[model samples]
Target: MLVMLTGAFGNLGMATAEALVRAGHDVRALDLDTKISRARAAELQRTAARAGINLDVRFGDIRDATYVRHAVLACDAVIHHAAILPPTTEHSPELARAINVGGTECVLRALEELRTPGRLIFPSSVSVHGPRLHERPPVTAATPTRGTDEYTRGKIACEEMIRASRVPWVITRVGVSPDPGASSVTLDTLRMLFRISPKNRIEYVHRDDVARAMAAAVTCDQALGKTLMLGGGKGCRITHYDLIQTLFDALGLGRVPFDAFGDESYYTDWMDTDEAQRLLNFQSGRFEDYQAELAARMRPIRLGLRPGRRALRWGFLSLVRPR
Candidate 1:
């Protein structure tokens, strides 16, 4: 299959592209012509060369209807993973809507023009469930969507559009799938972490697992017209406090301070991914694996910062909580 993947240079997109190529599918990877995108594209090319994978990378924005149409027409399947995430979405809601909702509309229109439209594998988010008020039943594909923020709302809108479209589609409401290699315990990240409630339940899925689910969606007949919740399975479910503590421990930063955490609920929650796992068979990664990967990446920095742990904590607290 010739697959056209939007946001092809993104963490999930790149992983999915690699998975597809390894599965004997030709990939037409598309993303913006930004510096980050270009760097990722180059890295992908080098990686593909070593792996003997076929990848045709294109640089363009998803909002370009003509370019999107051309790309869609040339491919047998579409994996839509392009979207502005939080902080960015919160900062620029209009741009988020333009790229997320408008871009999806462009793809759907392009598909509508085709005599034999290809399947669209849309990656939605668990944020569509919005802020959980109380502990309830595990969220499933059947759960009603009530997205609170712009990013999650955009995802919900895109999912609705896909559901109403004539194109064959599979919607995967993915949980938090952070790239272990891309994470750093920076001040900004620390500030964001401090805002999250300690008691909030969060499920994490590895990017590789997400890639596998995306690849399976391309040819799995059982996935068509279904909304699957993609999670990291039993081993990946953890409270926010546990997740932060694990990261702190991995970085040799000891225990996270209790005062740093907020009481407000976060937008993430545990998901029921049994149906998705049964259909796509993509849940193989564990949180322990991710923690190990993060630990390995942070080992050098951990060594450098171990002596200044107390000073670093004090500085971070002073900045996060003035006076």
Candidate 2:
């Protein structure tokens, strides 16, 4: 299979590309011509080459119908992962809509114009279900979409567009994926996580698992025209407080007291991956795996920062006022 993967250099995109290569599929990779993409594409190309995989890499805007058409040419499946993510999406609605929603339109249009009956595998965020505090135990495909914020609204718009198209499609509503190897995080990201109540349930899925699910969906006959819920299963279901505390402890930063956290619910919640697992078989990671990965990634840095533990603890404490 030849898979067209949009945003082929992002955290999830890169992982998906690798997964596709490992699954014996040729990939047509497309992304914006940016410094970041330039940096990652080489790494991906090298990996693919070593694996003896055919990776057709292209750098172009997805919003351009011509560029998207060229990228989609002869691809058997399209895994559309390109989108202006949150923080940026929240601050810039026009840019977000253009890339997130508009780009998706171009992909769909390209497919329609070419009349390809290839499978469309879109990774939709679980946030589209809005704040899932007390209403549901494990969110499923049947859950109502709540476009409570700009990001979720854009995702909902794209999902709707995909559904209305004639393409064979599957939308995998993915749980939260925090990159353990990330060296740094933005203040905006911290603020968003802080807003989530300590009581809210969060399903943390490994990025590799997400990549595997999307890649596996390409050939999944039963997954065509379906919406699957994916997460790390029961072990990954945890509270926001636990999520934050685990990171703090792993990185040598002191934990924030529970009272200092917010009380309002957030979008993240446990997902019922039974249906998706039955079809895709991608839930192979546990929360403990995530924890160990994070610890290993931060070990050297944590050792260097150990001397400033008190200062870091005090600084984190001062920043933890509940929203």
Q: Whose lDDT is greatest here?
A: 2
Scored by CA lDDT, what does every candidate get? 0.86, 0.88
Among residues 3 or more apart in sequence or in different chains, the pairs in candidate 2 whose N, CA or C atoms overlap within 3 Å are none
Residue-level lDDT of model 2, residues 78-182, one tens digit each, is 999999887788889999999999999999988888765688999898999988787767888988999988899999998999999998899999998888877
Model 1 lDDT, full chain set: 0.86
What TM-score does candidate 2 reach?
A: 0.96
Best by TM-score: 2
- For residue 110, model 1's alpha carbon misses the true position, in angstroms, by 0.9
